[model samples]
Target chain A: MTDSAVMVEAKGLRKVFKGRRGDHTVAVDDLTLTCRAGEVFGLLGPNGAGKTTSLRMLSTVYRPTEGVATIDGHDVTSDPESVRKSIGFLSGNTGLYPRLTAREVLTYFGRLYGMDDGAIEARIAHLAQLLDMDFLEKRCDKMSTGMKQKVNIARTVIHDPAVLVLDEPTAGLDVLAARTIVDFVKDCRTRGKCVIFSTHIMHEVERLCDRLAVIHKGRMQFDGTLEQMRATHGHDLEDAFISVLEAA
Target chain B: MNARRVMVIAKKEFKDVLRDRRTLIFMVLLPLLVMPVMFLGIAKFAQEQQSKKQSRTLRVAVDSNVEPMITALADQWMAENSPRLMITSAKIGLSFPAAGGDRKGLGTMIEQVRDMMDGGADAASLADLDPDLVESGVRLAREIDPADKALFDDASTISTFRTKTEFILIEDLEPSETRLPAGVEVPDDLPESWDGEQLARAIQDKTIHAAIHLPSNVFDMLEDQRASVPFSVFYDESVSLSEEASDRLAAFARIVGNGLLEMRLADNGLAPQFAEPIVFEGADMATPSRRVQAFLGGLLPYMIIMFSFFGAFYPSLDLTAGEKERFTMETLLLAPVSRMELAAGKFVVVFVAAVVAAVLATTSLGLTFTQGILPQGVAAGFDIQFEPEAVMLTAVLLIPVSALFAAVLLGVALLARSFKEAQSYTAPLQFIVILPAMAAMLPDLEAELHLAWIPFLNVSMLMRELLKGNYLWDFFGITMLSMGLLTLLTIWGASLIFRRETVILRT
Candidate 1:
């Protein structure tokens, strides 16, 4: 890691869900990880792997049942608003308002982030040009999924948050749509922004991540760099993921 | 909570909902058009139906023995000497003039009065003259056509002057030698005997409109009885033809009875007052508008409550459950906004929507009364402007009701996974409200101490009483407290649901 300030840190982050019939599920269990500024940290996991739960806690959307995760030193539970302000969160299920135009959606989010109208307008224009979007006034409902994804990306970074949490952002995307997300992650790293990207695509993890962690059953099975992951498990990340699950 | 942030959210919600055509239809167009058109159409339709029923042909099955008396009266009714058909209310002085016992002198005097009326003596100018004589003359002279003059002589005369009741004589002696009368048709499956029950069934089935059973001794009873005979008139009350047929038959009975009484008095040389006792006059003192107010008052409150609920329904679902279906909920939660602020924002939007709908409906009803939907005669006294106090209390009552609707709708809808699912959850709520809101319509239900605490019932009762110019202050006070407490509880519960991540994400 570079000698940059640590932007995201989780200390034994735990989430236990209570069922209606007096049962408990450990959605996240004592998971801990740290990321520095200017690094792309890849969280690799299959479905139902607590990848989303961990990201949710980090973004202050869900309160941790035990332990704590902090966004740039702001506690997710005790100082949730600050933690929320510090992180730009996106997930596969997150969607834009169908009735709103892209410009209106971006403006709404920017205002929620406490940006003045002028600043909101300025940020939207800047992001629109950078994302190479033309149909700012077009309603999101009628837009193609590729176009909607671009608007979603613009909304995620409207406040230019220091920490970004993207959970399977390219899960349903085709190759062309997936390329945009891969490039955006790279752009975040160049801007010295900390990004935690969770996906099951091993090739993507290999290509983009400077550091990586593998999780299964709400526990971290692996946390290290690309070299360390290969050396500890195997040369192939897919086989390595299976070995970690088998051990768990 | 940040007020400005809440307002921002509310403003956006308002803008979004205003674009929806469904909301506008419920909030504005329904009140503006549907109420007046439907109410007026119904009134006009009923009037037309009554007119049609009045002229319809009627058939009566009269026993052969009493048929002679009824036929004589029907003939007299058809003749120009149709006696004044006194409604039970009209008071007629019983004393006769000089030469009272002489029927020939009375006939000559009646002809003289008719001549005077034709010479342009109005009812007022001839007020000193006997009212009965003048009324008869006025009835004869006031018409352009002789047919119209004959109609002016009698009760429902448009039918009486024409072919009215077709009296078919049925001999009671033998069922073996009977061909069904063409006027009154019997059912083919009817028993061979003339059983009363079978005859009643035919009437009920409308196979025959009416069957008159004049007592077998009616001729002997009329000839020697000291008291009037009690004759049975059988006609089903449910059918329009039955009702109209019964009325005409009763009129025939009255004509025969009164003619007999007048002849008896002349023979005895006594005043006609001996035969008459007390008179019942049904003079309605209530203004037409007051009657309309009492009629519309009970109904108006329920409409206001129901319209308010419908108004809040879609907006609450669209903003909450609808957001989840669209998958934009997570994006909203991702902001630094508190759950309470989010609920508050949505509650305000839904509450305003409900008020807009209620106000529109109330205004439309008011206009319906004032703007010719009610006929000019009936609407003349119908001044139903709300007093400031009534308006103020009604508005206050709406606060809790709207709050309850907004919060409950949001909380319930939020549990749903999609807009259609949300509709299923909310649709049944209208039923839950209908029973209590309909309390105003329950005729004997009044605003009492125990009733004032019954949520929707309280508001409805109080609203009705207020419209009818009653201010039940204790009921109002207690109802407001009850509704306000319930509203607060609902809002608290809704915000709690909003705070629940499981509920929000539907995990």
Candidate 2:
């Protein structure tokens, strides 16, 4: 889509946490990955397989114990504020303020992003209509799981951020709600926006991922297209996913 | 450190906290109503119980022969003691008296009534008196000495005098028929001449709340030249009715005893003044307001400091650990705001809550005094004068105290993974201030150099001193400095914790 297209790059990212008893757990280790504008990148891993940890490092939510990542042209560590302004991040661990109405949640973030009231109001209107969020005035705590997910999705993109990093955003959503997120991810890619999504769902990886990375045990196991993974590892995508885990 | 961003964050927190019904209850309404209602309630309740106690009728019994004698004693005591008090000459002299219905101020009438009670005419010369001179009659009565009975001879005709102690003397019943109230017992062996045991049983059973026991042939024993009479008085100490009855009966004995001694002294040509050498005088100089302020000082500062701690408690938890619990903290951190800005925003909400609570408590107390809401006796003793400058200085001290509270609470609460865990951690914090805050409330704890450096104690003590109209400038400077240092250190520490991904993402 663009002559120069790389939007995110991670090189040798490492994160180690010291446990309460002084044991060390390496959450992410020496992982290298990249995603470009107009690309839907899938980070596939099981629970605690460094998928969320890597994404957190990329989003600047956590600092790398070693190495670095950059969003667009800004280094995440050196220019975190700019990096933050560029990326919309969502995960199972991130949620809406229940006491705040959906509209309030959006407006608050918009203000934090240095948006004027007029711009925030207009953007809220557009997102409300686009997301089918008729319950925007309802408090986040009052919403059903599906409705709450929609509010979360609206909050993630309220600033119209250029890069979207989603960590299992649809993990527990109903079918229709999951479809809304899937459509939104595809829509983000269609508008030449960069997307890095992590999930355990194989079907989701098959239907939406353009290029993928498999991380296991705090290390990247594979990084390539699904067809290339299938050719090298196994025929079935699920089998290839499991084989990669086993080999690791 | 964008002001607008910090302001935006602060405004948002205010909205969220204010909308929380529980927060508003502690922050706004409690401070507005508690003191006034509680003091007024206590005053009214105490007044009611007192009136009830004074008007109560107590059951009494005596040896059948003693009833008429006791009745005669009551009348004779009144007749002997109602002295002939002379009214001092005043400016407004009337020809014998004023018109039939001349109006006088209640103060003037009360003054005249007081003169009559002290040993003046039955009808006082109700001329305008210098209120100061009206009090001098007590001095005059003491100086004249009752030995000179002629000095108190009544000069003006007035209404009849009245005695203060009024009692309904029920007819005497037999020792057995005068049943004890409930839990009473008599000794098995009893003396025939002085059955003090039966009298004790009568009082214990509460059948007769009070009783006087006389010896058999007691009149003959008394009439004998050198013999003495032995008898006993019985009453339950715990029963007010019984206690009051004993007091009145004791008074009659005292009057009769004194009359005997005086008559003996006169027969020997001596004066009673030989035994009564000391003239006692008592003066109270404290105004009502100062008394109330001194009393309140020992208690209110503790409450205010405790409330300031509470004001920071929930909010700091809700914003830090609470965010982690709600899953919203990460979302907030992801926004392009610094941890300090976030911390500052949280700090503002809690500080406002603390200051608002303190101000409201002060306002409530001020209203309680100014509104005349206490019962008459209590109100008469109160004259609270709030110095505006002192209050303003006290407010300055609240700043660092509240800041330290917010920062320390937020920093500690952020370490927890949930609201309940945060609560346990913060609860012990309330205890940390307990010793120091209460130390300031101790009336004898003077503001010393060493105490000025102890953080919470210093603030509490400084606030207390400021409230009492003492500036303690050097102590104030040091306390503010120490508090400022503590606040900065706490804020820095909180910012450090805010920067920690381990704490922010504890769950």
Candidate 3:
């Protein structure tokens, strides 16, 4: 793996949903962060704290209402198609077509990513073996939660994107499914791919994150490595998380 | 914008939707089966009702003096026309040329005669055929003795009005009931009294189907040629059988009156030509095939428009709102393709589905008519003439309509958050357009130029004109251009919704 090189950047990104009756609800507010190649960046927040919204903007699923965000140097707003091509985004809102088999789902994403048929097939074969997904022929609707999560991860990395933005990828998952995500994150780091994953689990953050940010109420409260966090807010990662929230 | 990406999405969507049982049922199974089953069922029911009507026996009550007069006139007429009636009835069998195949040399003669009749050839054209062939055809027809045999063996099976009439003395009718059935209202214009009032009452009570009362005049009335006959037939028009019996009795009275007129004419030493000064011989220009095409053309547009909408209905919902409900819309949005590309991709699939459904439905219906699955008489009515050019043009006209349906359905369905919600949204859409789509069914509504600018109604009206072989080029161009513009607008609207994160990701 190469030395860290910034691959994802956000500057004062904001999203406000306009209601039908001329009301406004600010979802993500002026959040700034940078994630780099060869490292895992953790985004930590409480429920309704704009984690998914921020990731969506970075992935170009939603255009930022204000400010600039870019993936692999392509602006989310100005060059959203390019930004989308550079990143693989997964969230609670991101789901597979239930009627499509796992292989079909992967192939679909691969083709959408502009991958040729031979490369798509080769990439699918490699991911299937790596993810230990033997039931590739099974429809997504028929698969178990663990199996579906495996397919979801394969679909995410089918194009071997430069960056992966996973919003609570392990939420509601059993330990086995959660481990698959953990291992996938480590594999991405080793391969020098940028990964920005959001989670509430402190142990996962402490174990995998090279750098981390804690967002509270859509504003960044802490941005540093785990060692820096431990030194500033004590050794307990859970206490540090509490300290970060209290500081905010 | 990116055709390859759009096609990839469309191809995947097709595969995904085809696996869905609901989509398969609406998209394929229903279109294939609905027409044949409904048409056959209706034809069978109609046949049964017609046979029942034909076999029903009717009763007639005749005034005392008119019975013998009518019986004697009937006897004289029967003596003159019975042999002629047998020959004519036997000639009905000659329509089946298959019967003529049994005798050597008979088939060719029958073929020539049928060719002449079918071609609408006049007597001048009959001179063009070999004289011996014409003579032989006539001789073969005469050889079948009218008293013993018919040309076709299945002559007995031909359905005709065989209503049996039983005459009773009008004086024997029971007293008028006077009371109407509960809730039954009579028109206020009914007279207080009439000559056949008693017989009219018996007819109303269902004791008899109908009653006929004739003038009890002396034979001295026929002495004057200018005298108007006061023969009256009483029947309850509301009752079908009673109305039928009344019609037959009135017809018999005309025959008897005509016989009396002939006697008077002969006694006065005048010719029959004095009684008939003018006559009309009407002939229709439309071939049977053209007539059927005109009839079906009116119906075809309605089916095509509605079924095209229905075919696009489920898939659009499943592709848009269904994707939202399943949480797949976000994933699809995250792909490299633009919102326009995505919308276009999904639109293509839905459009193809709409076109396919309409084509299948119309094709199936057309085949059902052409295949002779309906009862013979009913089948004969559907001798459709589908010119290849007309069919291709009709299909061309359907394209913009189907595109409009796909785009609008996709746009509407995209707003809903779930499949059931989408269904509720789209169901009313069909009903709203149904009125405009059924414009072809209005017989008096001419295909006016201004109407060609309307959306569903234009296609409906224009398709009818096209199928009837009326290629109104200006109307076709107007409808096509207008509907195409509408389709492009709707597709643009759908793409706008696709680009909206709040709508695409609506939970």
Candidate 4:
């Protein structure tokens, strides 16, 4: 465990959304983090604190403005396709095609990941049981929110990606659905898959994170283990999170 | 670009969009149903209206100054041209001098029929022949050799020329209200006097269908065999019934005057040719299929182009803007496919939808015409059977057109943040496409060489020419080049948009 290789890393990552009138918005000014295989990393920040933007850059969903980020040793910018293939990304904004059934959505991503038909069917069968998605034949639109989230997770991990980047995956889920995500994150850690989970909930951070980073106004404020964060700020996780934001 | 990734994306998008009821409705149902219903509805409605107008009895107020002799002349014309009288005249071999086509052959046939009618018949009194004798004369005329069989062709057309117009002439205008024909109503507040301008006012107000004014000495002029007779008919051209009344009155006058002139020529021992200095018979050389092609050439292109645009419209929006709205775009972006592959995938689906819609609509329209769905008269004229080569070329033209629509719509729709917003952006695209696509429908708009360079208009005009069996190679080359370049340009633009993080992640 101590010698586990780094699975996800970012250094001085930045993203600036430029408007048409030459104005620019710095969504993530400077972000750096690292997560090793079998480690669960938590990104903690308030709303609009660059968590989504930074994670998106790492997942290769957004191009970094100025940064070096890699998934499974593939640079996000230089080798986006490889980086994307290595990582499974999910967020509050990521959605399943409503008209597509759970199995269809999974198969679609499987094929996009370069899996053959036989491999795709095997992967779908494996993921279907792993997620308990018995409603694989049902359309996403007809599924409950929990069912949809399960389908979304199945789609994310359809290729059995090595690293999972989940940006606020439990943001709007009910307690049961949120527990499903919690269990999934823990399961990924047990399977030796690197998991980067972003959320503002201190309870979730306390329960799941092996190491964590706190960002504020597009800049990193803190990066350390739970013991280190508590020792530096406060013993209470919520108070420590607040202290990090207040200090920044 | 990975072909497999593109295929995967395209396959998924096709499945996803096909499952949508809206896409199926636009892509299949509407195109298949609209053509036949609209065409048959319009044809049936037009026929009914025309028949209704033909059968209605129009009321024409004849001024007191109109001579009773004019009415007598009309009665005489109707009697002479009645189907029974014409049939009797035809059977007696009493052909008019004005009748054309092998005049000498008809003269010899008339001679033989007259001798067959009676051993020594007075030719001038042939009209006084008995009905049974006339019937026997017809059978005898039929026994002539087939070379002379052409004479009976005119006999069949004579009955079909029966006047569809039925006019009720009210001669006494002093008590205008009381003198009006039954079922004819005029406003009670009509002007007290039916004066010069008031007569026209009554026609305009729908109080009367038409007004006829014959010169006071018209009867005397007719008795003297004057070369010219002047008359005036006042009616509103804007009102169809009024216009028909005026036209029918003039036609009646012309027929009676022609009969009088023919009698005058006979009395002077002059041939009818002496009166008519010039005669022309137009020979239309176009076959039935060619005539149908001439009409469908203008219309089919407009329908095919417009429907193809519509077919691309919904799917393009659903795949692009709808993905953004549903937050599924980020999910798609997470795939290892390049933005170009993604765009190409969606573009292929949209292109197929466009082409399928166009082909279905065209096939449905072709079936409607060939299946005799239109009224008998209209259907009989439009038994369309397109040449295989022309049809194949026209279908090939749709490839570039559908590609253009799919690419342009995808690009434009991607800029929108929501499905409704995309609709707002793309709905107006119809007008932009329609104006150029409708170029073929303008009858006088020639397919000039320069027109072959304009994108949609070029395809439209070239398609028209192709459907009419014209293979203008230069125009075809130019249109293909222009359209291919435009499609490639738009597809490049769409892929560029797809590559933009801001657009893909918008909202």
Query: Which candidate number maximizes lDDT?
Result: 4
lDDT of 3 by residue, B1-507 (tens): 889999999999999989988888788888888889889999899888766654444555544455454443333333432212112212221111123133112223333344554577644344343332233223323443333223333322211111000000010111112210001111122333436666567678866665445565633454454577766777899887778666655554454455456545666798767687777789998888878877788899999998898789889999999999998999998898988899989999999999988988998898889898777887886765777898899899888888999999999899999999989888998887899999998878899999999989999998888887788999988998899899889888887888787888887
Q: After superposition, how far is residue B431 of candidate 2 from its true place, in Å?
A: 2.0
lDDT of 2: 0.73
Question: What is the docking quality class of candidate 2?
Answer: medium
TM-score of chain B of each: 0.75, 0.66, 0.68, 0.75
Q: lDDT by residue for model 4 over B285-398, one digit each (tens)?
A: 998888888889989999999989979989999999999999999988888988889998999999999999999999999988988787788788677677899999999999
Displacement of residue B89 (Cα, Å) in model 3 is 23
| Cα RMSDs, all models | 9.1, 10.9, 12.7, 9.4
Indicate the worst ten consecutive residues by lDDT in candidate 1 chain B: B165-174
For lDDT, candidate 2 versus 3, the one ahead is 3
User: How many clashes (backbone N, Cα, C below 3 Å) per candidate?
Assistant: 2, 15, 0, 0
Model 2 alpha-carbon drift over 4 Å, by segment: A1-4, B48-167, B170-274
What is the descending TM-score order?
1, 4, 2, 3
What is candidate 1's TM-score for chain B alone? 0.75
lDDT of 1 by residue, A47-156 (tens): 89999999988988899999977789998899988888888988877899888899989988888888999999999999999988898999998899889999999999
lDDT of each residue in A150-172, candidate 3, tens digit only: 89988888988999998999988
Better of 1 and 4 by lDDT: 4
Query: What's the lDDT for all of these models?
Result: 0.76, 0.73, 0.76, 0.78
